[model samples]
Target: MQMNDQRDINAPRAEVWAALLSADVLKECVPGAQEVTGSPEEGFEATVVQKVGPVKATFKGQVSLTDMVEGESLTLSGEGKGGAAGFAKGEAKVRLEDIPDGTRLIYDVEAKVGGKLAQLGSRLIDGFAKKMADQFFENFQSVVEGPADEGSEVAEAEGTDEASKKKGWFGRLKG
Candidate 1:
């Protein structure tokens, strides 16, 4: 499947770019992500748990960033193995544009699945993929913009300390 989307984030382009480079921020943004480790330059190792239709699996994956152009754009590619649940591979090309108030984040994504996941039908898989992408970007926006900009209780409840809460998700990550 292929998808394209954009989000207007209320932060400087540099800050958004930095957040994109941080594995900690990516872990917080990715839906169902249990763990995400490593740096953008070295690539990341991730474990995520999710249920699609009737299949529930823990996916072990490696994610790498390529075609990097500093704060402007990059490509993210990844593949995961889920034992019997199936395997998934995909890539996203992400671009950041400077806006008057903040930055415009745009992405084009393509994904494929095999084994049981592929057997679940394209409609189901497509919807799931779209939802995952949306959730990731939404969380990323909240992290970069901070709770002051978006005011999400869910963000607050996600185990941040009082100091970190006041600092904003991205700011806390910088420490």
Candidate 2:
């Protein structure tokens, strides 16, 4: 599958760029991310979980970033598995554009799946991926933007504190 997503963040490009580079912030931002570990030279090792249709999987993926152009763009690829549920390998090209009041972030992603996930039918897979992507962006936006204007509770369901960090779903997948 292939998808494109564009978002305008109400922050300077540099600030947003910094957040992107920070492992802690990225871990706080991505959806369904139970844990993420990395070193730039070593790439990102992440474990994620999700339930699609009736199938469920805890995917462990290693992501490598290449063709990096500082804060402007990069291409990242990785493979993730859901155990008996299936697995997927995909690549995403992410670009950032400076605007007058904020920055525009865009992702062009392509992915392929095998195992039970591929067997589930395109409609369901596409739907699930889209929803996950949307939630990720929403979480990222909030992390950068701070809490909503309504003064809502913090959305750290992904777990942020040292305690939660040690006990998070991602922590369980660390290797």
TM-score of each: 0.88, 0.80
Q: Residues 91-169, candidate 1, lDDT per residue (tens digit)?
A: 9999999999989999999999999999999999999999999999999999888766344455567755543443456
Model 1 CA lDDT for position 45: 97
Query: Which candidate gets the maximum lDDT versus the true structure?
Result: 1
Candidate 1, residue 166: CA error in Å? Answer: 7.3
TM-score of structure candidate 1 = 0.88
lDDT of 2 by residue, 23-94 (tens): 676677667789988966678899887788998789998988888888898887888987898898888788
How does model 2 fare in lDDT? 0.75
- Model 2: weakest 10-residue lDDT segment is 163-172
Regions of model 2 farther than 4 Å from truth: 148-175
